[model samples]
Target: MLSADRMRAHLDNARRHLDTARSHTGRVATATGTAAATTGLFTTAVMGESLLATLAATGLGLLVLPTHKARQPEPEKVIERTADGGMLVYTPPAPPSHQGRTAAVLYATPGVGLVGVLIAEWIVPGFHWGEALAVALWSAGTWLLRPARRARHMLVPPLPPVEKVHDLVVQDEPQLYAHPAAQWWAERVAIEGGAAPATVLEDVEKTGESAMRAIIRASIPGEPVPDISVRRLSALMDVPQDLITVGPVPGRGASVQLLTVGQADAAALDPARLWAERIAPLAMPGATITAINLGSMNLSKEDA
Candidate 1:
């Protein structure tokens, strides 16, 4: 079976290849269109028409040259091993998007065509159909080469006003944030588990195939967060107490983080043994252990 790292590597390589192919394809289209237009210009019998067509084709070629857009690198977060033999997964918030810049480019692209038309008129005194056609083709090619913006819909749309919601809407997918379980779990923990009233789920960080880290925050102003025990957290998370570790988030006073190993790991460890061996070491060393792929740590009785 292929590992997650290998799969990610393969996907990245494929994306690079696709980007190269897209660049080549755009260049080829521009070259072919410009060449065909130029050839027709020379073949025309009328001297005046041929001159106009030749000038138009030259202008089209210059305008149609592919523009390279520099891609921004994505921000990456890491799970670091703290000196106290614990893992701290810190994921910074995503940066603002470049949609505004993209919109500006979209709006400015048509100006290139306008500029071509103005230059063509300067070269050939009167307005000609040949120049108009070249401008239109250049504009079309520019729009076609660029990727179109897609309209996005929320996976779970916001609730309407209290009077409008006649029916109940349920969200699924317990393991991830794309559904209701993550939010529900946090709310339940806050409301029923006697955490803070303003507590909310910050993020769900997956450590490996065998474990995940859930970050919950209590948002009461000017008040210190109450200590939440592992027993209560385990009950809220629906896992064995031994499989869960509750810790305070450094620098974030009202926030707490919980690490929960999978049930398979539970069978391998005698209550709390898994934490000392796999995760606790991260806290004790103080060194950042960046690469961790704990794939199914189900061992036999002798191995345990």
Candidate 2:
């Protein structure tokens, strides 16, 4: 299998090639149009060749273009060293990133431009040059106008009512908050686990009471601690509070909560662990990770 670093380098090279091709195709189209107009023979074989060549160049340029991919951390691998110091294996996380809409725009722009040029060159035989220029100007004007209108609509969506329930969760507990469970649980876990107790405590205080309550609730399912904030997990999970109670069990003569779960879970609950696991790995000797392919099947197959 190709390494992540190798894959990234390959994609970068592909992007550069596509960019260069696009530039060359644009130049070809401009030169072809000017030549056809000055020569006054749009129906000739030479004109057809120029038009087709421009389209083919633009198509090839679009075909090789690279799209942006999101970077996702690999799955946690709990490696156990053998006598020879070789490590045991575990499954990695699946890739998470995808191409954005800009890629579609990039692909469509050249294709559409090619079609327009071809139609203009072939259908009109001897249409006035001014009419062709006017059509191009009007199309450009419409494209520019639509995006501006869309931007205005996005800028002013309707706001929710003030009375509606809204919650904000943090990694730490909050002050002036009614939920004692969040504060108690966070401090207890940090102290018992010998995790950074001071930092954990400080996070709880900064997150606010509402956010802390939501974190506690989400962390421990079926444990209704209090009436808090948002309904969606995306909002609830983001509570800045780092501590999460994975489960509760009787330990050391009391019902103590299990603070840590799997390695991935631990990383999610603790910022230090997360940074160490995800970012620190990149610093390791020969450690290089690449994003999964974001292009279409044909591109992926070609790369393979």
For model 2, residues 90-162, the per-residue Cα lDDT tens digits are 7766554333244445444534554565556566666667545744653454344433222222332223333
Instruction: List residue ranges in candidate 1 displaced over 4 A.
Output: 1-181, 192-197, 254-304
Candidate 2 structure lDDT:
0.43
Lowest lDDT sum, 10 consecutive residues, model 1, at 148-157
Candidate 1 whole-model C-alpha lDDT, 0 to 1:
0.52
At residue 25, candidate 2 shows an lDDT of 52
Report per-prediction Cα RMSD to one decimal. 30.8, 33.5
CA lDDT scores, all candidates in order: 0.52, 0.43
